[model samples]
Every structure is written in C-alpha cells, then in structure tokens.
Target: MRKTIIGLDLDRESSQISYYSERSMEPETVSIQENQDRYLIPTPSDLFTLIEGKVELGQMTLANFLKTCIGYIGPSVKPENVCIMITMKEITLAWADALRNACQMIGIPGEAVFLQTHRESFCCYTLNQKKELWIHRVALFEYEDTKISSYIMDIDYHTKPALVRAETGKSINLGRQGARSQEQWNEQRDARFLEMIEEVFQNDTFSAVFLIGDSFDKTWAVESLQYLWSNRRRRVYQGRNLYTKGACYAAMQRMDIGKRLDDFLYQSEDLVEHNLSMQMEHRGKQSTHMLINAGTNWFEAEYTCEFILDDTDEVVIYARSMMGGEAESYSIVLKNLPERPKRTTRLQMRLKFISQGRCKVTIRDLGFGEFYPASGKVWESVLEV
Candidate 1:
C-alpha cells in the first residue's frame, strides 16, 4: 500500500513539516508572479507568517501549494523515486505537540511520521572544473536511544574551512586531520554505538533506512557499521539503504517511511489483549459493591450484627468477626435469621454482646467485604411498611 509520509524538522525558532503521498512526485518550488519581489530564499520570518493562519486551512495549505508549484515547475524528477524536503527552526515542546496533533488532524496517521535530527557536515568538490569550494551541508545522525556515547555532531562545516585556513594559510586537508580524527573518536566508542544500533534494529521494524542530512557524514555512519561487526565477526544485513544527497531540509523532503510507519502506530493483538485484561480488572474493582459503614474504628470492643428486615422477605445475613484485635477472634456466620419486632425494626438495634477491650466487625452480603463502627454506631432502618 502507498504510505503517507510526513517529515518533521524541529528547530530552535520555528518547526517545519512536509507531508506528501508516497505515490506523488516530490514537492518543489514554483516561480509565482504574486510576489516576484520576494527573494528565492524565503526568510524565516516570511515563512512563519505564511504558515500561521495556514495551519487551520488544513492539508490544502500544503497539498494545494505543492500541486500548484509542481505544475508550474514542470516535470522534475530525481535519481530516487522517494523523498521530500522541509525546512523549519522551531524547537519548543508546544510546537512538537502541535505538530503531532496536526498530523493526526490531517488524517496522516501515526505510522507516517518519520522523525530525524539534523547534523552539519562538509563536502569538497570542483564546480565546473574550476576552484574547489567546500559545500556546507546538513547531515542527519540516526537518533538511537540506546547509544549513550554517540553525540549528534553538528559541526558548522562552513566555519570549519575558514578556521582551517586561519590556523594554516595553506590548503587544509580534512581527510588527513578531521576525518581521521573522527575515525579515531569512533574507534574509542564504536562498540557502544553498535550496541545502540543493534538495539534499534532489533526493537523497531524499519524496512528502509534513510541516512538524510550531510552527504559526507553518511559515509561515516556506513563506515562505523563495518567497525561494529568487524571486531565481533558478525554480518550486518543490507536490504534497504537510502542515501540522501542533499542538505538536511532537502533530504527530509525526499524521505519515505513507506508501510513501516503504519506498523509503528498500531499495537499487536497480544498487546491489545493485555491492555484489555488490565482494563477489566480496573473496572471490576470500581463496580464491586461494599458496605462502607460496616467497619468500626480500632478503639472499639466486640461488635454486633443486627439485620432489620422490613416488608422485604428472606434476607440472609453473613457476618465475619475482624481478626488481629486484643482478642484474636475471627468468625463467619452464613445463616438466615428471623424477622425483628414490629416497632423495634425502625429503632437502632444494639446486639447485647460484650468482650474485653477493642475489636472490629466485618460484614458481607452477596458482594464484597464491608466494615462498620463496632461500638459507636448501630444499624437502624427508618423505613416502616
């Protein structure tokens, strides 16, 4: 089945989410004449204004825009059939909650939300056989909850080239210094990282893995996988491998969760059954009836049981003597007693019984246990028929 994929990028100031049908073409920018004065690179403030009232406009705000843009931009294609890009910088918990709610509201469903954190990395290449300029890009490091030591390294790749130039006025070779140094860091903490990745592989049913973000760091993630099983001599499965060849935002736009997202949202039958059992136990406890006034305080002596039967016929009284008092006594009486005196039925009846010091009384019917005040209060029926 075609999956509905939604990519969420949580930023410091504003958040961005990209939603598209799995079968539809990737969303692209269209040159609209409405605002030709606006720059190609839309400012964060402008994007914020556009998205504000537009959220209430429903998926049409995105779907209509994408349809219009794609129509205008013409038939643009990619090397890979899947992936969509989104850019945003909001990082508040409120935004996170809103994004989650919005996805549900849009009928996107839970299975389609593919969440990833972005990291910055660099790539050096010759543009048109001219000068070699370092391309600053964002890389996505897979968020493995089990990986304790692996840090999401978001190095400002743009600043790194300048810093390298300032430190050494000659050509700065990152492959020798930076990349090698990173490999060393990985060597020290590689085992723990593998354990984390392994835990995720075991726990989650992810069909395809999209290594989105910096193109250069993608190599590091792939290389690190080798280091993991090399020491242990275990083979890593390579069925689904997706490499995003663009910035974090660009890569997010092209990502697809496919059917995996759907599986993530729905619980297994076993889990549902277990939850149902727990609910039944909770409901049973709440519905079970118990006489609250039957129990007495800890300071009382021996208690009495007197059932005042009105016109209602045949009331079987079951009484139990509370254990663990000054007098260690516990009794269970299951007997049908005679009806009380005519006028005396309306008055409170005090059973003429006395003990040593303090005790408690427990009374029960067809339902559950009920404790009453042993000495302070007596059972009285105000109903006279």
Candidate 2:
C-alpha cells in the first residue's frame, strides 16, 4: 500500500511540519493549524486545559495546540562515524506519538509519520545535492537565546563513498560569557572563540560553514563575525522553517516519493551501523543467519527464531560495526537446557537491543514435539558486543 509520508519537526517556540503527496509535484510546508502562516505554527505553554478537572487533549485543534504548547522534545543529533544506539526521553516519544495521532485525525496512517530533530534536518537540507555536499564537508554554527554550539559533518571514505562522520560540540552560554557591551564582548570573546575554531580546523577540514541562529543575523552588533570566513566559504541564514522543509525532503526520501538519496548515509547516534549473525549447523552443513542487520534503526531491530541445539548449548555470534573495522564475535550460553536426544531439543531465541552496549537475548525451550513434549522452561541472556 502507498504510504502517506510526512516529516514532523518539533521545536520549542513553534513546531512546523512538511509533507509530500503524489498529487503535488513538490513537498508542501504548512502550518499545523488553520489561519496561521503556511509554514509556521504557534506553540503555547499550556496546550491542554482541564474542563471540570478532565484534560481534553484529543480536540480537533490538537495540532494547533501543539503549535503553541509543546516544548522541544528531541535534541539535535550529529551524524558520526560510530554506530551507536541512542535512546530518547519518554517525553520525546510522547511528542512523536501525539503527532502520529494528529496524522491519524487527518486521514493519514500513523505508521507513515517520521520525526526529525532540527540538527538532523540541517544535514538532510545540505546533503541532497548531487556532488556538492559530498564534495565539501560542512559545519553548522548555531547561535540561540544565550548559547553557541557547532556541528561538523564530513564525508567518510573508510569503505567506498558511503557516509558522513559527525561531531557535535557542547553549547556555551554567550550571554554569561560576553562582556557588558557588544564591542567589549567581541573583544573578550574573539580570542577564545577563534581558538576553538582554530583547534577544530587544525584537526579537520571544511569547505563551507553554515551560520545559523538569530545571533548571526545581527553580525553588525558582533565583531567575531569577521573570523567566520577567514579562508573558507560561509553561508548565513536565520530562521526556523528550513528544518521543516528539510524534514519534508527526508520524508520523501524515506518513502522514495522523489529522487532517491544514495550517497549520504548518516551514521548518527540514532542510526545503527552493525549486524549480528550466527553460524550454526543446519542438518549436516553450516548456515548463517542474521539476528540484526546493519543500517537498520536499532529501535526497530528485533527478531525471533526457533532452532535445534546441535552439540552445545553455547552459540557464537559475530558482528561488524559501522566503523568498518574487524569482525568481533560474541558467545552466548543457554545455561539450562533439558538433556535429550541429539537434534531433538527445540529452542526459541529472541534478539533485541536495550542500548548501544546491551542486546537483550531470550531463549526458551519448546521441546521437540508431542513425543518430547514441552519443558515450560526459559532462559534470559545479555549479549555485549
């Protein structure tokens, strides 16, 4: 069945959404509420009110309420070379869940909805070009309310021309860091800021830099702007709509609604870049089965299989990480299994990741059939890779 793909961008001040439909030639960015800017939606502090002590969050204007009420749920993620599974706050999932409900109210399937953080959206925005984005590494400098942060995204060539290695910086409060006057602030902050930039450039290379946040718009008031492009190219932008549009493009790519994105594989904390497989004896020959495949979202990686224990209750699983490094093997023991005739004991195994460092494994005994009957026994395990 055709999927109703939509990109949902959730932010603090206001939340924006972009969508792609086959009926339209291009993606559309519209306000979540009526009578609002086509690309802007309001977000209030109190989205729900208690009428007689019962909160009515299921109103038709729920999207409208989210526009003015929801705070930032998901934080920014930098695309890195590491294949790690990152968990989100329960509050963040609540935002995505609510948005999916909103999509259902509008005749869209909840399964088709996707969430993108503003930072990941920025990567989607710049990586769409044929060779431009891959040709040159890009950096993002954000200037918000009272802090400054940065992200470095570069092309990784470890294995073919595959993905981007991202590095995110800790944000520093500019208001507390600056002096009394703008000029004095620059005079005091230029050296420190320049040192930070120099340290990064000393270790890496960048073809272009993106200056975001409202602070960049007021370069006239800040003198540190001069060093933004001492030897490289720079792009200055100030707004919130860019993320929504990028998210729209992301949705299209996810559903293959438009041109496919082939070259830019983002290896962020949210992306899993490893696969776990086991080599076992099937009949008289050896066979391999993947418990979890690389390039799949960790949250979505789950599988169950029933196999007969060969000669040992111990099983060895091999993994290849996104780092494109050597293959590592992990051994798991079933601990307790009823002794039976060779190849007559049936065992059910399940694989799932509870975190980047932990993959939960569960094994249960199903016996061999009516002849062998059931054991009503189970064993839980943790496979650390």
Best by TM-score: 2
Please give, for residues 319-384, the per-residue lDDT of candidate 2 as tens digits: 888567887987777676777888888888888766544678888889999879878888877777
Over 4 Å off, model 1: 1-8, 13-93, 96-183, 189-192, 198-212, 215-223, 227-385
Name the candidate that leads on lDDT: 2
For all predictions, the C-alpha RMSD in Å is 23.0, 8.1
How high a TM-score does candidate 1 get?
0.24
In angstroms, give how far residue 153 of model 1 lies from its true place: 24
The Cα error of candidate 2 at residue 57, in Å, is 13
Q: What TM-score does prediction 2 earn?
A: 0.67
Q: What is the Cα-based lDDT of residue 52 in candidate 1?
A: 53
| Per-residue lDDT of candidate 1, residues 1-385 (tens digit) | 4332323333333333333433444322223344452213222443344445445543334434333322332244221232333223222223333443444443444333322223211110011111211121111123322222211111133432232110101111122234456667545444444455565444322222223222223344454566433533232222101111112223333343221111111111111110000011133353321221222211111233334333432322222223222322223232442243332232122221111121123333311113212222222221100
Off by over 4 Å in 2: 11-14, 23-26, 38-120, 130-134, 157-159, 176-208, 211-216, 219-233, 242-248, 268-274, 281-284, 295-300, 320-328, 339-345, 367-376
